[model samples]
Target chain A: MSSQAFTGGHKASHQELPPEFQDQEESIKITGFWMFIVTDVLIFASLFATYAVFVNRIASGPTPAQVFQLNTALIETLILLTSSFTIGIAIWAMRQNRQRMVTWWLVLTVLLGMAFVSIELTEFAGDVAAGWGWHTSAFLSAFFLLVAAHGTHVTMGIIWAVALLFQLRRRGLTTVTRRKLYTFSLYWHFLDIMWVFIFTVVYLGGRLI
Target chain B: MHGGDEQHETAIEPGFDFISPRFEEPKFPMHQVWGYAASLVLTFAALWMTVNRIMSPSVLLGVVLAMAVGQAALQLGVFMHVRESRGPAWHLVPLGLAFAIGIGLVGMSAWIMLFKSGVS
Candidate 1:
């Protein structure tokens, strides 16, 4: 019975993975990363959907156009876009084995990321000070959740990149460093992408509505 | 140009293995160069449309949301390389979840718009 069960399990495994691609370690991790991205995508998608549901709700509160400062948002957008480009160049520097260039570029990216978050938080503070609290309306609640989620991710990305900088400083560019950098780039780009949506939907759509 | 000896340009032999780390700088720099440019244009164009509420409020809202979705797709597919990653099928799995989100959004919107006051 034990031998039969073993054979059955082997056959099941073989059916799942072909012979040539049977390596478990690398393929699993790559697939796992993809799955992780998909899950994150769903999280954002749900947020988007929620925003859509209550988009018209103001509860006699401030609307997007009245609340969101287009100029400030534009400034924040520029900051994030430039930082992404700088980080991309930093990755290129890493590829070229230019350590000092990498460090400086990453430092610039961190500062820019911080600048974006501070401006965003300031905008939120201004909103609250203007008597438009998160509880004021369904729209405000959804807006806070979505934008705050993205802001939190950016803050986390800055921290993660700085930590990577420290690791690179201590150990130089090893395979581990390369993998970390690759993951960080993925994250930074993801943040940029989410910003694109937030800017378009929240800022723009809110004004239009 | 001064290869008068038998050792011509073709005679040069690299010391390393035939398949070395192909670390030549990116040939198709278009992806790197154009990625952010496209993003900026899309973002600004969206912002321009939003500024001053350029059209009917409802229509503008819908357009902005649609454009945002497009922008997000560009960022995810191009910048994040989500679709081009090793296991794209795994990434595609979220489509189902997004569909569920759509259903939930429509349902919740209807509930809130049509029934929330009645229930309260």
Candidate 2:
């Protein structure tokens, strides 16, 4: 079936699969990664549910309106969005066999991701300094937990990207490296999608309500 | 050069013919460009609505949420290549189930918290 699928395409050639899907094993691994992403969806969904329940539980603390800075959120959104784009381009470059371009774009992605984390940390620090820490109210607690979870993910992604950069430098664009890069891109894009929800439901919706 | 080598290698193998142009994948990366533009438009539109107070809170919330979902679709379809799979694509089965379960988790939790009782 796999061979037929490879040959069935009109462009059937010796290389039937993309670099990332070059092997049946690699293809299955990508599918497994998707499953992992589904579980992550559930984790975030539960957090969203918790936030919804506590969004109104201010309890004599700073409200969402007072806390969320639209300009900052917008900037963060743009940064992450642009980083996602760069990573996509990186994968595209990798497919084109442009190893240097891939490394450069990946580095850019890591930088932008770092900027996002720093901005998020600044926001959290400001809140805590203003006596609006998570302990102040249920709303604040939910807010902190949800946003922090995302921030932690971004931090880890930066680390992962750096590691991938080293691998790309050392190994070039072999199938194994390509598969890893592809999965990393998927993970990065998934995080951006999650941020869309966070910006909408938490930051924007907080102010709207 | 690598592609030519692959074709030669496969030609020697039994039951394999030289790949035709019809089977060739498109070389352009236009999908990524389209996804990026769509994402930017959706993001700015949601931000504009929130900043300008263009609608009631409830209406704006619904619109923004809808836009978020659309953005996700664009990302999955274009950037993530979510449909690119090998074999029978059993992964999508679990993915579909996950989506249903996620929606149920969020929806039921919100309902229970907001309404206090399903029977009520």
Best by DockQ: 2
Task: Compare the candidates by lDDT and give the number of the best one.
Answer: 2
| Residue lDDT tens for model 1, A1-209 | 11122122212332222211123343345446555655666677677767876777778987767888878989998898878877776765665566788789889999999999999999999989988888999989999998999999899999998999999899986645755665677678767767877787677666665
Q: Write down the TM-score for model 1.
A: 0.73
Q: What is the interface RMSD of each candidate, in Å?
A: 15.4, 6.2
Candidate 1's C-alpha runs over 4 A off are A1-31, B1-29, B52-63, B83-120
Candidate 2 clash total? 6
TM-score of chain A of each: 0.84, 0.93
Q: Taking the candidates in order, what DockQ does each have?
A: 0.16, 0.36
Per-residue CA lDDT of model 1 for B1-120, tens digit only, reads 232222221221355222121122342335556767876786777777766567887777667667666666665554444432211133444544654665476447535765545532
Question: Which residue segments of model 2 deviate by more than 4 Å?
Answer: A1-15, B1-25, B116-120
